[model samples]
Target: MREPLFLIGNVNVDLVMGPQEPWPQPGTEVIVPESEFRVGGAAGNTALALDVLGVDYRLIASRGDDMLGRWLAEPFGARAEAWTVAEGATTVSVGIGHPDGERTFFTTTGHLHSFKLSDVLSQLEEAGDGRVALLVGPFVIPALLADYDELIAILRRRGYRVALDTGWPDGGWTAQVRTRVAAWVGHCQHVLVNDIEARGMTGADTVEAAAAIIRPLMPDGASLVIKCGPDGALAWRGNEHVAVPAPKVDVVDTIGAGDTFSAGYFASLVESSDLARAVTNGVTVASLAVSTRPRRYR
Candidate 1:
């Protein structure tokens, strides 16, 4: 049987559209060839990817008590039983995809701020049953973010290995942001970030240098991995680095590529017990996700 796993963080609606060549000007409308509405957010995207990969995990997240919230929850089925419904509109992200697979997003905070430590603890029915809990989108969830240290301590006490993947902050990686992230990183056994985030968080130009800077701040046995889009991913663990190359494919969408990669990496790690294999699985899964129109996660 697969090990007990938990995916905790934001869950929201996503309106994806585009391929517009140039940035649109104010008061002008630019029509795109394609558009899609789907579940998104760091944990939301990961949950969807895990489902496609046939991985079992308990999802602990929140949604607003609105129509889109109801619409978003339908995709998770029974796994969303413990999800909290906050008294507000669901967070929605409008992702505009570029021709090169890069994308930009416009988002609303909505109900994400309603998730708290109590909700997380309450939903952990089988705490400590196995190992591995992924925490994502830290900045967006103020209630949970405020008690992040306490949350990690509780999870650690419950014998769950914590993995962190905080998506980019709205204000970018400022000094205060880096300092706060550093504090949290110390408690996590796994820290995953994309290439840009890695560099920005550490002020290091290269991923290797960034890992070098970040590893010292975390605990002794912690691992750090950087997702490098089409080039692939790299992981630093146990004083060594592992490189995983991504397979090339025609691009389709890149909105949740990082989130999907996180799911695949950890899932493969739990199953295979190999860092290289895990990173390989991550990039492979992400490549598949971005190359397909409907977005295949397997």
Candidate 2:
């Protein structure tokens, strides 16, 4: 039987510049560019990818009682068993980029600021009787991290395996956060990290070097995936490693590419529990995502 997957994270509105030049310095006026608002966020993007892969999964996250929130929620209502609209506005991210897809982000916390771990626990408790796997990352509320140890303990006790994606470290990473989350990774079954995140964790300059640094740190059963965009992705299990190139395709927006790959990998796991196949699926999906016009969330 296919196991049920659960994604817990942020859901936000994305404002993307259609055609923009380099950002001007403070007090320097820049030419206006086309823009569009769209549904995005790690939560929504991951869920959308899983949905597209025809996986049975539930997305648990907080949204606001505003238009952006509504737009984020509509797509998942059919598949989501329970979703909440907290008493605030949904988060928004302004992305400035060129036609070639190199971009920068300016974000506002908005409703995601109101997220509480208790709310997530309540939703999970309600989910009931199924193999629940969680794909977590850094874009989530800080409160979520604060409760992670407790949460992972509960999920493990409940017989659920956890997959972790330590999203980009902001304002630089400190030993304290790394120690706490590292301990948590020891308890996880899988970890999704890029060369950057791996380097942060182990202080290696390259992905291969970072992978070497990460290999011994992973728990007894954990698989650590090092995702290098376009170059390819490497899957590590114990002392073994395999590099799989991403499928060839025309480049577009890379936003949410990692999340989409996570979804595909997780979906493959739910279906077969075969690590190699899961990694291949991730590459396939990420290729599909990066080849599209502008941005493709799933």
Candidate 3:
């Protein structure tokens, strides 16, 4: 049977455009070559990719009571029917894609700032041991961030293993944030982060060095995944360390690539529990995601 997996985080709207060569001056409207409107967020991207990969899961998130929320929820269909509704505009991210799949984003806080642990608890009943709850972008959710420990305690009480994927902090990664992140790492059963996030969180210069620092902080048997774009991914649990390489593919939209990797990794991990295969699947899926235009996760 597939492991019980659920996601907790934002499922906001995303507007993607560009690959334009020049940075236009202020007050000038620059038309880009391509654009798309879709659902996105670390958890949202993982949810989309997981759905495509045929994984079973629940998403504990809220949608703003607005047109954008309605629009974003369409792609999720019945899976979105139970999500909570926040009292304002839905969060939206504007992604400007650049050459080689790079991107810059302008995002609004919207409903995410108000999402809380109460919302999370309402969606899930008491689960059996071994259920995995992937919590993404905690730093962006003000209410959730403030009650993180309580959230963890609640999830543990309901028998779920947390997998934290705290996306970039809005206030930048200061020393205090890093300290808190380390505490979260020590508490979670799994941790997923990209090379940059890993380095930034651990104050380590290299991905390997960062992994080394993070591995010791994790609770016994917890998995630590460091996604290294293009080059591939690495996973360390206790004394076991695994590395996987990614295939070369044409550059396309890089937005949500790391989140896509998270889906791929956990989807495979749940199926077989093989660290090597999970890492390989993650890199392969993410490689294909970056190279495809409409984004195919399988």
Error of 2 at 171 (Å): 1.8
The better candidate by TM-score, 1 or 2, is: 1
Give lDDT tens digits, candidate 1, residues 178-297: 998888899888999998999999999898899889898888878899999989999988867898888878888878899999888877976787788888899989999989978888
What residue pairs clash in candidate 3, if any at all? Answer: none
Query: Going through the candidates in order, what is the number of backbone clashes in each?
Result: 0, 1, 0
lDDT of 3 by residue, 1-298 (tens): 2766889887888999898767789899998888998989888999999998989988888899999988878888887888889999999999888776688889898999888888887887677377888889888789988998788878877778889988888787899999988888877989999999999988889998898888889899889998888889888877788988888888788888999998898889777988888888999889999899778877
Clashing pairs for model 1 are none
Off by over 4 Å in 2: 25-34, 79-81, 126-132, 294-298
For model 2, how does the per-residue alpha-carbon lDDT over 1-298 read when each residue is reduced to its tens digit?
2756777787788887755665578888676556667778777778778787888876778778887777777877764436666787788988887767777888887877777778787777543344656656554576676677887777777767677888876655588767776777777778888767888876678888877766666678578898888877889886566788877788767778888888888878877767788888898888888787654534
- Please tell me which predicted candidate would have the highest TM-score against the true structure: 3
Query: What ranges in model 3 sit over 4 Å off?
Result: none
Model 1 — TM-score against the truth? Answer: 0.94
